[model samples]
Every structure is written in structure tokens, then in C-alpha cells.
Target: MTNSTRIFLFFSFGYFVSYLYRGVNIGFSGFLIEEIGLSAADLGLLTSLYFLGFALTQIPAGAALDTWGPRKVNGVLVLVAAVGSVIFALSDTMWGLMLGRFVIGVGVAVCLGAAFQAMALTFPTHRLPMINGAVVALGGLGGAVVGTPLSLVLDVITWRTASFWLAALTVMVSLCLLFGAHDTAPLHNRKRPTMGDQLRGTWEIARTRAFWQILLFPSIVAGTFYAVQSLWVKPYLLDVNGLPGATVDGLVSLLGFAAVFGSAASGLVARRVERWGISLYHFCGLLLALFVVTEVLILLDVPLPRAFFWISYGFLGGTNALIYAVLVETFPRHTLGRVGTSFNMLVFFLIFLFQNAVGWVVELWEPISVGVYPAQAHIAAWVILLALQTTAGIWYFASKQPKKLEHL
Candidate 1:
């Protein structure tokens, strides 16, 4: 295989593990609640710790990528995720699960950024929109597996055993990345920036108004998308739509399947439209707005086919990834690791908040049963999500046309 192909496959597998961990909780939530006596809030706290760990590591991980390159950085850190998965599999207590999830988050935090960094270094800039989308789509199969496939796995084995398998998979990926993937062509005559210099560059990227404008809407939207996909959607299906376990799993898998297409199409369409003078930024905004509409329709509990809104949610939701391509166009390539991770920090931190908030909101009402919450509770949380996303969308659309960042 070509070196570039090797890089894509290995790095993409790393991201697949990352995405798998993110959504694994969805498949395991019922098992956790029944096995560990977890409440909705407790489940939220545990599931979101992964995102918290992921968010916390973004800045530092970015700096490491710039200094040591993606292969070395991701290889070493993903071992931490293996350790975490072991912890999670063995733990019966809430605190133990939270710790495991957080460590896993820290371990895999670099997966997406590293993959994108390696790709950007290898592929031409014009091709990144499509390539990045393809990577996300392929990685999204991890998400797809956590749905019906995970349910089927759990039918034969326990969640703990499944987690053990996941850990082993993680370890294998780490070893392959460390041994199989070559580092980017090194900087030859240039002094590698000190950690301080790398951090300062990150700060410079952070301070740009255009950066906030470009990232704000999609960050919130992506956070909401992940929050639901990872945790609450199962409960929502159970309580709101009154769907059975088998049906819910199928729909969840359908959402995952739909998102893969959404991800693949976003870049292809964005690149295609750019020839007609449409900006990537505007295309992302349009999809995000349509995503908001999907949420509204979902909340309205419209009598339309139940699958329709979910398919729309998955499809439109995945398109937010197009923002990365937009960032590539706006920022210098040298700063991309930092810029990408900084954006990730915001997206995931918000996911951390949004996931917990959904649970906290649901907890406001009494449960209909041992673990099932009332429909009103979920609707309230869903409305709050809409309000936040819609407000961010408005700000994005209302902002002045983005100008080039002065610092870059």
C-alpha cells in the first residue's frame, strides 16, 4: 500500500476506536442501569466524562502533534485508552466507570485531530474536504456498530466482556499505529517550536474573531448531535415514542447509517458548490439550520414517519464536519493541529455539558418506571437543545461576512 493510504487507514482506525468509545455507552446504558443501579443523572455523568477528558486534552495534544507528529503522539496516548477500557470493564461502581470513561477520553482525544493532521500533511489542500469527509464516514461505522450490532453482541456476552474486547481492539490499533504508520516528513533546517511557541500559536488562533464566528454554530450543533447519539436518544425513543428495544436498536443503527452518508456528502457537495462561488461556511450554516429543523420536527412529535426525522437528524447532523474544511481554508497549515484541537475542545466540552444537562433536565420529572423518564422531561430537554442551537445559528447567520484573520 502507498504510505498515504497506510496513514489514512491506521489513523482512521484510531478515530474509529475514538468514535466507538463515544457511543458505546448508548448500547451499554441499559445494561449499566440494570447491573449497577444507575440513575439517569449518574449515567449522564459517567458517559460525559469521556468528553470531558477529550476536551481537556485537546490543547496539549495539539502541541504534542506539532512537536512529535501524529504517529508517535497518538500511539502512546491510545494505550491510556486501553487501560481505561480495562478499568471500565472491571468496575461495578459509578465512580469507577466515570474514571474509566474519562481516561479513555484522554487516550483517544487525539484520534480525529491526528488523523486530520496526517491527512493534511499528506494530501493536497483542495482534496481535504472530500478526504476528511470520507475519513469521518468510515470512522462513523464505529458508531453504526454500537447500535444494532452492539445489541446483538450483548445478547451473547455481557457488556463487561464486550468492553474487554474493545480494550483489546484498542491495544491492537495502538501497536499498529506505533509500528506501521510512518511519521510525516520531518522539518529539516527549521527549529521545532518549543512547547511555549506552540501554545502561543494556539492562543493566537483562539483570539481570532473569525475563528469564533466560524466554529460557534457548528460546535454547538455537533455537541448536540453527539449528546443525543451517544446517550439520550435511546431513552427518548423508549419514553417519547414508546418504541420497543428491538425497534429502537434498528432506528439507532439507521441513524448511524444515515450519518455516514451525510458525512460523505457534505464535503463532496461543498466542493462541488464552491465552483459556483458558494462558500463552505454558508453551506455548513445551511445544513446546520436544516438540522435544527429536524430537531424541531422531532420535538413536535410530528405524525410523519418516525424514521424520517431521525434520518434527517443523522444526515444533517453529520454535515457539521464540513467546518473543518472551512477552517483549513481560513487558517495556515502549520497551525492546523492547534486550530483543529481548539475547535474540538469547544465542541466536546459543550457535548460534556449538553449530555449532563439532558440527564439533569430529564431528572426534573418522576420516572415512569425504574429507569424510564416521563415524556415531558425529555421534551423539555429537547426544547432547551433547540433554543441553544437556534440561538447559535442566528448568531452565525447574522454575523458580518467573515474577513481573513489579521494574525495569520
Candidate 2:
């Protein structure tokens, strides 16, 4: 393979595994609840804790990636994730599972932040979008290809044993990273900025109108996306829409599959949109609005077809794919890691809060037992998530395009 192609494969493959590690916990969460006898709120708390660990690593992890390179940072962390998987596999208790999940979060946080930095560093500017898209789409394949299968595997192998094997595979990848991934030394030949200075640099950008598009949209996309995927739609369909459990599972599977396409499509769109002076934010936000509209349509008893949800997710994924590149191009490469880390810290916390908030809304509605379905409380939380996404959409359209900014 060509150097560029090799680099893409290397980073993308690592990312594929990273996504697997990140989502494996989410897949097993229901199992944790059923087998461990945890409540919905308790499950929310555990997932939130994972985000807490993920959030804590943002700035530091970013800095490490920028300065130390992905080999030292992301590669090694995947090995740590392997250990985390082992812990999770071994632990049967609630708290122990939480600890293991947290470690996995730490591994994932580093892997993603570094992957973006590396892709930016290694890939050519013009082809960046498609390459980036390929990475996301390919990486997302882990979820699409294996999410449900892995979940089913856990049924046969048990979560712990499956985790053990997954970790072993992750560690092997880590070793390959150590031996195969080469770190290009800094070309600028400049001393690295201190954390305080780096923080200030990002902070200044944060105040500018430009940074708002990058910073703000990600939160909405991540928060609402996680809120829904963490099984909000499943319960909504089962309790409110009268869909069967099998139907819900099939839809959930389709959602992950859609995400893979969304990731790739968004990357390509991001690349193309930048040429037209349109922001990826605008495209994503607009689609986010569409997704919510579909939900509202369903709520109102309109013939809100299933294609609407799938199509909307495609748009959502596309919009999200642009975020990292936006961050990469908007800042100096040296600061990419720091800003990425800081952004991720915020993103995960919001994800944690939003997911639970969705759950809270369900609980408040008072369980309405229908058929085999367990009724959740009020669904006001989903409404709120929809609202947040709408707000993001509004902000995106109101903002000036990147071309407009250049003219000024």
C-alpha cells in the first residue's frame, strides 16, 4: 500500500477497535441490568461514570497525543483498554463493573483524540475529508458489523469471557502499534507550548464566533445521539408506539448500520461542503431538525415512516463526522490535541447528562404496562433532547460560512 493508504489503514484499524471497546460496554449494559439487577437510574449512573472518566482525560490526552504522538499515547492506551476489558470480564459486582468500564472509557478517550490528530497530521489536506470519512465509516463498522452479534455472543459466552478475548485482541493491536506505527517528529522544530498557554489559545478561540460552530454543535449532536441510541427509541417504540421487542432490536441494529453510512457520508459531505462555503454544522443541524421532526410526526400520530428515522440518522452522522476536521483545520496542528481533549471532556459529560435525562423523563411518565413492554415514566426528556438539537440547528444557520469568514 502507498504510505498515505497505509497510514489510513493503520489509524483507521486502530479506531475500529477503539470504537468497539467504547461501545461494548453499552451493548452489555442491559445484560448488567438484567443479571446484576440494577435499576434504570442506576444504569444511567454507571454509564455516566464512564463518561466522567472519559471527560477527565480530554486535555491531558490531547496534549499527550500532540506532543508524544499517537504511538505513545493512543497505541499504549488501547493496551490499557485490554486490561480494562479483562477487569470488566472478571468483575460481576456493580462497582467492579463500573471501575472496569471507567478504565475502558479512559482508553477510548485517548484513542479517539489521538486518531484525529494523527489523521490530520498524516493525510493530505484535499483528500482529508474522504479519508476522514473512510476512517469513521470503517471504524463505525465495528458497531455495525459486530454490535448486535457481540451482544448475542455475550449471551452464549457471557460478558466476562467475551471481554477477556476482546481484551487479548486489543493488547495485540497495542503491540502492533508499538512496533509498526512510526511517529513523525515535529517538523516545525519549535518548543511545545505549556498547558496554560495552550489552554488560553483554545479559550480565545472559544470566545470567537468561529469556535462556537465547532464547539457548540458537537455537544448537541453527541448528547442527543447518545440519548436516543442508549435505547431511548427502543422504549419509545415499545411503550408509546406499540412495536414488538424484536422490532425494536431490529431497528436498533439498523440504527448502528445507518451510523456507519452516516459517518462516511458526512465525511464526504464535509469535504464537499467546505468547497461550497457551507459548514458541516449547517448540514448536520438541518438534518438534526429533520430527525426531530420525524419524531414529532410520530408523536402526533402522523404517518411518520421508519425511513425518516434512518435517513435522519444518516444526516446526523454526516454532520458529526465534520466536527473533528473542523477542529483540526481551525487550530494549529500543535494545539489540535489540547483543544480536542478539552472538547471531548465537555462532549462526554453532556452525553452522560443527556442520556440520563432521557431516562429521567421516561421514569416520570409513570410506567404504563402494555403487553410485554415495561412502561417508562414521562417522555419529556426526549423532547428536551430534540429541543437541544433544534437549538444547534438554529445556531448553525445563523452563523457565517467559512468562506464568508475569509472574506472578512
Candidate 3:
């Protein structure tokens, strides 16, 4: 009925699709590995492709939204994601699954960037931060819904069929965007540069030391956060902590529940940092991660303390919220959508690589001179992540300046 409602719906649709691509993997990973004979490594590598595809399209996606407008681009991308879901459902091999996931990867970058660009184009400037948080919170809801209990539904039916149903939902969402989820004004920025300029966006950012400042922090923050959440947490609970059945479910629920608050909290913090600020928001995140890893290591050395389960939850939740909210504020909005999408791509790619390598690195360490503690190994895994965040902090502090919301 109104412009605001239309903007909200349209943007929500984009995240809804982006998250569907994310959520389905957790639900189906176990089933697929068991049925299709994919190893844990295979599942990690293949699912990571979704992020890679998502990352790869950032610049183009932002430009598409800027030039083509969200209505057309969002519809096409959702349809493409639906196709990925369908392919994943039908696949019996790892390579086939990778192809399917890659489709999702490519489509989701468009979905995420287009949604944000739509918000920037349509919503009032003051509302963008909160609205952006709302989109992520919605996606987290989708993720929480797709966990073990939902996976049980896949048991009764086949996960393959479930995948098909998810795709079908995307198709429904695509229709929703096509008809109801649209704005009155089109984003035809006549003064904007040619398509070639848009395509060179990522490269342009790469050229600037300042871009690296904006770039590396998000890569570490998002990479480690998502990597752990997606690939390792379940195993961390099952293997490291020795949590079983109901306990595992409850813990997973805790992580997701914390995320709900974390997303909103991030936006609020960003708003609060309107004046002079002195903190390594992203680097502090890894420091928090260090605290988490060290605590987990202590728990491993001795008897389990029930307190840790909640304390660790709070620590991670706080970091997650801060990192996300800090993202929008860290860069210029002109290239916000492009940088955001590209950042997601790099985060995904690095998360997959580092996460996969950690295990082997640990194994290699254990047999050699230093006896390996797995928790310590993860702490070490985070060392490089923290260093990158440090580098990012130095750059953000020294080079670029953020504009006030009044100007945005």
C-alpha cells in the first residue's frame, strides 16, 4: 500500500532467499553425506562454494541494483537460486552438489546486495541501519528453523524432497517480489558511470590501502563467525564438548537465539558510535574469540563447568552483533552494496579454506615437537584471523573517514 511497506517486503524477500540458500545446508548436510557418501571434508568444501558464488558476484550485483533496479534483478536471482536448490536436490555426487551450491552462491550475492540497494534507494536514511539488521535477523530465523528438528522432518520425508520444497518456497518468494514486493520509483541513476566502471569496482577497492582496511576486518569477522557457525559448531559440540542429543539441540538453539539479539544489537551500537570512537570493533571480536577458545581449552583439560555453556554463548553473541553492525558504518555507501557483497565472497572463501586447513594443521602439530591441544589449535587458527583484523583496524583508523548519517 505504501512505499515503506513495499521497501520492507522487497528487501526481506532478498534476504529470505539468501538465507534459504544458507539454512538448507545445515538441515541436509548430514543426510546428504550419509546417503550420497560424501565425507565431512567433501560436505565442507562443497557447501563453502555457496559463499564463494555469493562472494564472486558482489560487484556485479551492486551495479545491477544501481543500474537495473532491484525489481528486475531480485526476481531473476531468486529464480536462479531456486534452480540451484533443485539441482542440489537431484545431485548424487560431490561435484554435482558443488555445481548446485555454486548456483546458490552466484544468486545470493545478487539477492543480498539488491536488497540493501533497494533499502538505500527507498527507505529514509536514518532507518537503513535498523532495517538492515532486520533483514539479517529474518535470515537468522530461517537458519534457526532449518536445524535438527527440521532435519528430522527430512528423515520422515527425503532430504532431497525437502530441498525441492525449499526451492519451491523460493519460487513463491520470487512471485511475491514480481508482484507485491516492488517500489513505485525505479533506481535509474543517470549520472552513474558506465557498466565498465561498476565491473571494475572490486579491483578499484583492492587498489586502495584504505579498501584493505575496510576489507580484511569483515573477512576475518564474517569468515570466522560464519565458518564456525556453519561448519564447526555442531561438530564442536558433538566431538569436543561431548554434548549429546537433546543437549546438542539446546546448545544449537542457544547459539541461534543469541544471534537474534546480536543482529539487532549491532545496529544499535553502530548508531551509538556516531561521534568520536576508540575501539577495534573487529579486532576485539577475535580477542573475544581467543577468550572463547582458551576457555574451551580449560574445559577440556578439566571437568566441564556448566557455566561456560552460557558465558561462551554471551561472548560469541556480543561479538557477532558488533561485527555485523560495524560493517555498514565501516565503508562508503556509494560502493556499500558492492563492497558488502565482495566482502561476503572473500569471507566465505577464506572461511572454507581456513576451516578445512585447521584440522590438518592440528594433526601435523600433534606428531611433531609440540603436543597439540585441539582447542589450542583453534586458538592458533584464530591467530591469523586476529592479525588480519589488526591490519584492518590500522587502515580504517588511519586512512578513511565515515560520513555522518545526516549526509547519507
After superposing candidate 3 on the true structure, give the runs of residues whose Cα lies further than 4 Å from its correct spot: 184-195, 272-334, 358-408
Please give the TM-score that candidate 2 achieves against the real structure. 0.87
Q: lDDT winner between 2 and 3, please give it.
A: 2
| Ordering by lDDT | 1, 2, 3
Give the Å error, residue 39, model 2: 0.6
lDDT of 3 by residue, 1-408 (tens): 786677676667667657656656666766676777765556667777887777667667766666667767778787888898889889888888899988877766666566666666676666666766666665565545555566568669987787798788888777877777656555546356566887676677566554455456546655666666655566555544556746655555566655655565555555555544644354434444553454445345455664355435434543443433344555555655665566656666776676565444444434322221345554555556556655654554465443323221
TM-scores vs. true structure, each candidate: 0.97, 0.87, 0.80
Q: Which candidate should be chosen as best, given TM-score against the real structure?
A: 1
The sequence of per-residue lDDT tens digits that candidate 1 reaches over residues 142-165 is 878889999999999999998899
Residue pairs with colliding backbones in model 3 are 53-105, 54-105, 55-345
Q: For residues 1-408, could you state the per-residue lDDT of candidate 2 as single tens digits? A: 555455566677777776676556556766777788766666666666657778877766765676677766777778767777788888878898889878877877766666666777777666666677777777776655344566567668877777888888787777766776576546322456688865675566456676666567667777667555654555566666777655656666676777777777767766576678766556556655666676566556556576466446644554466667665556666666766777777788887787677656555544444212344353466567667777777777777654322211
Q: Candidate 3: minimum summed lDDT over ten consecutive residues — where?
A: 364-373
Show model 1 residue runs off by greater than 4 Å: 187-199
Best by lDDT: 1
lDDT (Cα) of model 3: 0.61
Candidate 1 colliding pairs: none
Relative to the unseen true structure, what is the C-alpha lDDT of residue 319 in candidate 1, on a scale of 0 to 100? 83
Error of 3 at 371 (Å): 23
Better of 1 and 3 by TM-score: 1
